[model samples]
Target: MAIKPAEIKKLASLSRLVVDDKTITDVTDRLSSVLALVDQLQSAQTESIDVSRPFHIAQRLREDEITESNKIDELQATAPEIYNGFFAVPKMID
Candidate 1:
């Protein structure tokens, strides 16, 4: 599908995109390229392809493990104020 500058401008306004007159051509070209790719994909013949079978190989995953670090005293020591093991800050709301 051929993309026009006026259409690009309209879309840009609708999508809150800032597109100047000089940049409209560039944006139109990029949009046209994307539409061309869509056309290519739509024209492909995939009726014989098996949908149940995986198209790509699966990746191996690492095992999840839990680890603990006790640094409460170290963090509390640097705070200006602490209440019940938690840092205390000035009240922000009225």
Candidate 2:
């Protein structure tokens, strides 16, 4: 799984990634090691591994109901200018 200089250039061109010669060498080594580990895992006996060993997840549906309502009097009190029951702001257009 050792990536060549030419292969790295090809991958960089396709992915639009900018990599120098030094960076290419480093990335090649890292990627080759990762691929080697993946190749080893692929050959392993994973069929006997239990799926529920990690954790079990369950989704709970909530009832659609208005639990609490907003107080309009408190909201209107904090307004700069209140005409009936609305906050006034400066006009955007000249």
The candidate scoring highest on TM-score is: 1
Candidate 1, position 17, lDDT = 89
List model 2 lDDT by residue over 1-94, tens digit each. Answer: 6778788788889999977886888888888888887777677788988987476767678899988788888878877787767776778889
Q: Give per-candidate clash totals.
A: 0, 0
Model 1 clash tally?
Answer: 0
Candidate 1 regions exceeding 4 Å error are 44-94
Query: So what's the TM-score on candidate 2?
Result: 0.42
RMSD (CA, Å), each prediction? 9.2, 12.0
- Model 2 segments more than 4 A misplaced: 44-94
For model 2 the local lDDT of residue 21 reads 82
Task: Give the TM-score of each candidate.
Answer: 0.43, 0.42
